[model samples]
Target: MRLVAPQFQPRTVSAFAIAVFLALTAFANPAGATSPSQTPPRASVMTVATQDRVDTRISGLHTRLQITAAQEELWQKVARVMRDNAGTMDSLRQARASNVNSMSAVDDLKSYGQIADAHADGIRKLTPAFQALYDSMSDVQKKNADLIFQTDHRHSAKKG
Candidate 1:
């Protein structure tokens, strides 16, 4: 699926919605367990792993939309949320990786809950901005935006 810039979609653009969507997409990826015999990667590596993927997605969306000067501010808001969501997940993953060896079953559950909560928070932050942007969009832009989000959501669901 192609990422479109905010300029392309004038009907509506919600930073919060996109952030929430991205978070949901990331979580849908099966963070499959590492083999018991396999050692986890270093913390630095663990934290850095998701950055590139997030950047690429955000960049692609921005480019495709052909965002205009007026839309730049709103686009930045969405992009920031995307980056923040990725960073939050990376931190959660890093923490889990570092503690997995010592974590109890309950601890594992708590960690998972924390990750979920963080994603929720990200969505909350993203919603208002996205809504404002979405409201400003044109009908054509809205359709394009809808298709983009729908495609990404479906793709993530399939992957999950």
Candidate 2:
């Protein structure tokens, strides 16, 4: 059986795409760095800001899902997975950024493969926790969840 349902694929793919874009673009160029030699300061700031955004998204999702007292534990599990996945992606992004200027074409492709692998691993880890929470949801909550995912997918697709 598929780990993810057909309806969920677009949302997952869109999220992954956005994360990849952000990771790559964060290191692309600085608007007004005094010197090309400067690196860590900007990248560090971006990483912290990116992590904050991840946290905000998780909190937003929790609110949007209307998670209840009983569901809190399951919701936390899902949140933890999300945070961990983001951390993994951040690490990968940092590693790639550190060597980005010197990377050969093959190395660049390999770096992308690492990102893709992380995405897949994240989904693999996320699916069951989300499924458990989803199964526990009331019909109204489930509908809300579905709508949120659908809406997010559309928004991300438009941005892409």
Span of ten consecutive residues with least summed lDDT in model 2 = 30-39
Summed backbone clashes in each candidate are 17, 0
Stretches of candidate 1 off by over 4 Å are 1-19, 23-46
- What lDDT score goes with residue 145 in model 2? 78
Model 1 Cα RMSD, 1 decimal: 9.7
Report the C-alpha lDDT of model 1 over 1-160, residue by residue, as the tens digit.
9746333242364433543666545632213222233343332343445777777777887775566678889988887877776666665665567668776666666666666666677677777777776777777777777777766655654664
Writing each residue's lDDT as its tens digit, candidate 2 over 1-160 gives 6345234356356443444333333333222122223222322234676678767877887898899999999999987777676666666666666777777666666666656666667677877888899899999998887777667657755765
Tell me the alpha-carbon RMSD of every candidate: 9.7, 8.7
Q: So what's the TM-score on candidate 2?
A: 0.73
lDDT of each: 0.61, 0.63
Q: Name the runs in model 2 displaced over 4 angstroms.
A: 1-46
